[model samples]
Target chain A: MKKLIFIFVLLIFSFSYAYQFYGIPYLQQVNDFSLINQDGKKIKFSDFKGKYLLVFFGYTYCPDVCPTSMLRISDVLDELGDYKKYVKVLFISVDPERDTPKALKKFISFYDKTGKYIVGLTGKPEDIKKVAKQFRAFYQKVPVKNKEVGYLVDHSAYIYLVDPKGIIRMIYRPDNDDPKRIAEDIKQIIKMFGTGE
Target chain B: MKKFIIFLLTGFIFLAYGNEIIIKDPWIRAVPPSSKNTALFMTIVNKSDKQDTLISVKTDIAKIVMIHKTVEENGIMKMKHVDSLSIPPHSEVKLKPGGLHIMIMGLKRPIKEGEEVKINLFFKNSGNIEILAPVLRR
Candidate 1:
């Protein structure tokens, strides 16, 4: 009877564990690259070694998805509370031609209320493309009808969660639009990776 | 007496046709001044037994407004312009983030939080209705 009860409990636990959440664990190791941050300073990927980085690739001109994702990341950071100290959000602009260091600084600062953990990065078009390719991301520029608006970019909307050791641990999909769930996932990753709360 | 009869007929017609669709929680996410495109969100409920199609949206704040659907194809998110959206009978259709939305392009002016923007939505069966969507900071 004791053995049967233990097996039943294990079965219940396994059933619950089979359920999946919003973010997907990719487990692909990330490579480091140097890019200019929002402060006009050249920062290397190694500079963020000990911190969990929430990386998102978007342009400054993107009004809906980019801003909404940034806001969601900010909300997750806020919900992390004291644990927020361990996390850093990076906004990498794919539109290198238009999104200069100054443009990125102004655009990223608008969404972040605290403005401490969030940082914007932009580099040369080639470098940006190379970095995006390393992460298996895609972006394309399409011309629009308006003369004033030259073009708009269609890109992947996945937000990547990088561990302290620079591994792409989890990815928040565009369809998974809940911020609170993302906070919970971050906490889970921190605990699993033994990265200090 | 003739005027009263005409008013009663109009009221009956409105009750039969116009009062079926209810617009709820309509709002636009506030964007920075430099950003050019923004999306509008709302929950539209069809209370009547018949279905309705949302044909188009118009706003003075923007030069063109298109109904768009965001789809994830091969892990890349892309927005496709849709002609009309169907709202089933006794059902609700939500225009939310990362889903269906009204895409406002060519912003004439920057929108601020708490500012009300007037929008006209034209439907195939229910005709046109005006909504004042408050600019909300998300």
Candidate 2:
């Protein structure tokens, strides 16, 4: 009985420690959504099963925040090294009007030219809105004064870490989180809960 | 007499080149092929006694060059066009990623890594200063 009580205490401690993640802990199943990938092929969220997804919402036209986040995500993938095969980065465009499949392909190629790891997704405005709602991501178009540059899109820059089972396990703010720490957390998650593979 | 003449030449050189606005670590973010846009970042140092304002930027590679600042509110990121950036005397202004940057749009061609982009920065006090910013990923 004493050994059983000691074992129970140890398990509780381990569970609590395991839950500590560098990003915000969010252990809820993600809602599935369909969108068009960079190749103009239809893709569903469930299709990424058995692999972790690093998802963020932005537009290709955004020269500042989007590229910064993309670079950070690339660094995170670099930090993963050999384990990057088990991880995938998803860049969902909120500006459907300008972010067509071809444009997305051009944008993502700067980060991942081979197109094996990083995937850019876009769809109709309504469909994009629906997916953004599912992930609680906010985005809106704001018209600018410049004629050559018609408008800009404002978006939330939270990077969601979805597990292999389509569950969002962590949230990272690129402004605050380091890529190395984010990669470490993903590795910890994979160790704690086997990569569903 | 030789020492005095050398001292005078050095003073003349300082008078001609010293106290000018200095640009450090100027670079353009390298984008993919067929990309229409990218951003430039650098640190503007003002050593003069008067404040200077960066009124406009011009580049031949892009159709439009605008000063833009990324503002974050309630976790939302928005890029706002800045008419001018003011650099105080004896201080430095950093235009970096996720903050103030020079937005270059409508690129004529892909700016690959290791390439240099010539840009002209017009300042209120310093007039136009030309620089060649290297294209880089960081």
Best by DockQ: 2
Clashing pairs in 1: none
Per-residue error (Å), model 1, residue B74: 2.2
Model 2, residue pairs in steric clash: none
lDDT of 1 by residue, B1-138 (tens): 999999999889867865589999999988877667788999999987789999999999998788988777887767777989999989999998877999888889988889999999999888998999999988
Candidate 2 lDDT over A1-197, as tens digits, reads 67754664465357657566678777567778899999999999999999999999999888778888998898899899768889999999998898999999988988986689999999999999888888899988888776777888889999999989887877887586588989988888777778778
Q: What is the C-alpha lDDT of each candidate?
A: 0.83, 0.87
Contacts from the true interface found in each model, as a fraction, amount to 0.57, 0.69
> How far off is residue B137 in model 1, in Å?
2.5
**Per-model i-RMS in Å?**
1.6, 1.4
Report the Cα lDDT for residue B45, model 2.
96
> Which parts of model 1 are misplaced by more than 4 Å?
A1-22, A192-197, B1-11, B14-19, B48-51, B88-90
Estimate the overall C-alpha local distance difference test score of candidate 2.
Answer: 0.87
